[model samples]
Target: MALVEQLNRDMKQAMKNKEKDRLAVIRMVKASMQNESIKLGNKNLSEDEELTVLSKELKQRKDSLQEFKEAGRDDLVDKLETEIDIIESYMPRQLTDEELEQVVKATIREVNASSKQDMGKVMSTIMPKVKGKADGARINKLVQKHLS
Candidate 1:
């Protein structure tokens, strides 16, 4: 099923099961996607657009999670961890380090990137291929390591 449809089904299931936390997370994702759709002046988002919203939401939660951890807010940290887990459940399986490295290597070769100087070129070419499959920072670090 499409991501949105899946979210809808899961949302209903959460409601029926009286899973407040899970329902809240599903609603949050649905709302984010809806808002993105409106922002683009469209009624529906394409799968890629849906993935973008999911990735963006996941990234925001993760960034917030880091800050919450640094602040030693154990109370908020646990809640955010649960939220992160819920959000991640809707995302595509993350790339394994070896798989990500292989993609980076192939892209480097494809782009003829001899050094970190071609970072932008390599990154632009590779990101679409690995979108939502790998973290940008992880890819950037891997590219830098391979190049240097």
Candidate 2:
């Protein structure tokens, strides 16, 4: 099933199970997806666009969790963690460290990137291949490691 379709079904199940936190996260995801669609002139979002939205949502929650932790707000941190978990459930499985390194090395070779100066060339070539499967920060680190 498509992600949106699965989200709709999960929303209904959340309501049925009286899962307030889970329901709230699902509603937030649906709203974000809708907003993205509207931004694209009311067209349905492509899978890539949908994955981008999901990743953005997850990133926001992670950032919030850090802030909440620093402020000593365990309640909010817990909620944010839960939301992160829910959002991540919809994302593609992330690459392992070794797998990411292998990909970065392959991309560098493919782009003929030999030094740190070629970082941009390597990143541009690799990002599309790993989109929705690897974190941009992690990819950047791997690229830098291989280039330097």
lDDT, candidate 1, at 63: 96
Model 1: worst 10 consecutive residues (lDDT sum): 1-10
Give candidate 2's error at residue 43 in angstroms: 2.5
Q: Candidates' TM-scores? A: 0.97, 0.95
Candidate 1 similarity to native, TM-score: 0.97
Encode model 1's per-residue lDDT on 38-147: one tens digit a residue.
99999879888988998999999899999999999999999889998998888889999999999999999999999889999999999999988999999999999999
RMSD after Cα superposition, model 2 = 1.2
The C-alpha lDDT values of all candidates are 0.92, 0.91
Error of 2 at 22 (Å): 0.7
lDDT of 2 by residue, 1-148 (tens): 2999999999999999999999999999999999999989866888989998998998888888989999999998888888898999999999999999999988988989999999999989998888889999999988888777
